[model samples]
Target: MFQELKPIQVETLLETNKNETPINYYQCDSYVLRRDTTNSCYAIYVVKALIEILYQLRNVLFHGELVPNKGAQNVYKEAYLILKMILDKIR
Candidate 1:
């Protein structure tokens, strides 16, 4: 459940793209993900969130919604770092 996640984890999930310029999908719908504790691990929840964010980014890029820029790069970097954290926890 989300309650089991560390404060920083929840905070990161909630606020990672709050300042992304040109706006990414995550900034509008961070609450779209839910705590599906009945059938998944905490890592899966995080991974699912990551996937959702990435999918949104992919859609934006694929559709030419926003020109790639430094802010977009930062979003990618943040994703990679979050992914690394999840991998570290699982390993």
Candidate 2:
């Protein structure tokens, strides 16, 4: 899980989280990455997917596009990726 985060992957997650870039260059594909990385990958989705989802979330939140519900876990999941990134950096 946490073991699956490469330095670049961590950085990419944080960058996407901070900058709200609805894209990720680090991950090839979520479905494939879910298999390529590890079965219990660090994020609920691949780091790439989390980044894109978080960026979209920030956009929706910033623009008042819709009331927050349903996918709130996605943001929390992104936060988890951040924490994992920090922890991995520490290690």
Candidate 3:
């Protein structure tokens, strides 16, 4: 599930350029996850980005912006899987 969501999370991160306004910027007041371009921990960054994506997903749903569609289902599913993965790890 992590592998499946990694690309999507990375793509989201790429699309959200740090120089521009990020999703829920007014509420979060910053990028979901700060990416250190100089850092060598690429895997760590990906994981953090996944978490951030999940956070944004929650905001989208809460704001009633999530359309009931296939794409929305996929995004929600990915976020769910990632959350489950994190929970498993911490336990």
Candidate 4:
């Protein structure tokens, strides 16, 4: 499962008015945040991030803010698979 997992890429918006540039970081073992040099973006731990994402999704769903689009479907599918894999291992 870990082998098939891909790092999530995050990009910082440039502060045009402040003339500030974002600094690129090297990968570390912190397990919270890491820089993916190949992708030029920051990556986060899958399990941690996924759980937070699901929580947010639940909130949006309950509030009727979520749109059942293709992208949303993909996210739901991926989350289901990962959660199912973990449950299978535990059982």
Candidate 5:
């Protein structure tokens, strides 16, 4: 499904620490979240969601939530809709 994501081109922003450095967390091998911006920043959250969506579809292709059929395709397609929604809201 990676071929269909049409991945949203977002500039991922990481959160800062007391010394104003970026923060990163390796949330398992499938997903990792890194924060660099200050509070209220959304770029990181959006990126994290995108990554999660990809990971889910990738692993679900076998025998979990999605079968190796048409349903898996739909999950990937929704990510594009989400991208459009985010862009519209930002613009």
Candidate 6:
């Protein structure tokens, strides 16, 4: 479902995650997420990245590789917001 977000919406999420530090990793440079010359492919790359990260997180949790902690508060909060945004868009 998340993979289906509009290009603009995906860009919005990518920007939010990058600037807001919700993911606790280095900010993803715009070029890394998309071609600098065009906006056509960024959304697809961003959605793919998001899904991959989520899948990695799921695996870590499923395998008990990393225990949940209070520090992940922002992750939960941001995830809900992103999901809500997608739901609202689809509806």
Best by TM-score: 3
- Clash counts for the predictions, in order: 0, 0, 0, 0, 6, 0
- TM-score: model 4 vs. ground truth: 0.42
The weakest ten consecutive residues by lDDT in model 2 span 11-20
Tens-digit lDDT string for candidate 6 (18-69): 3332332234554323232333545566667766776676677678887778
For model 1, what is the C-alpha lDDT against the true structure?
A: 0.62
How do the residues 4-75 of candidate 4 rate in per-residue lDDT, one tens digit apiece? 675765544222233113433432354224334355443445456667877787788779998788998898
After superposition, candidate 1 runs with Cα above 4 Å error: 1-40, 77-91
Best by lDDT: 3
**TM-score, model 5 to reference:** 0.33
Query: Looking at candidate 3, what is the lDDT of residue 85?
Result: 89
**Ranking of all predicted structures according to TM-score, beginning with the best and ending with the worst:** 3, 6, 4, 1, 5, 2
lDDT of 1 by residue, 21-72 (tens): 5333242453633332345334455767777887787788789998989999
- The C-alpha stretches of model 2 lying farther than 4 A from their native spots are 1-34, 37-45, 68-91
- Candidate with the larger lDDT of 2 and 5: 5
- Relative to the unseen true structure, what is the Cα RMSD of model 5? 10.8
Cα-based RMSD of the predictions, in order? 14.5, 15.3, 15.0, 14.0, 10.8, 12.0
TM-score of 1: 0.39
Q: Which is the better candidate, 1 or 2, if ranked by lDDT?
A: 1
State model 5's lDDT. 0.59
Candidate with the larger TM-score of 1 and 6? 6
Model 5 Cα lDDT, one tens digit per residue, 1-91:
9868968775543323233234443343555545434466555576687768766666666447655557657866786677678689889
Clashes of 2: 0
Count of clashes in candidate 5: 6
Q: How far off is residue 21 in model 2, in Å?
A: 38
Worst 10 residues of 5 by lDDT: 12-21
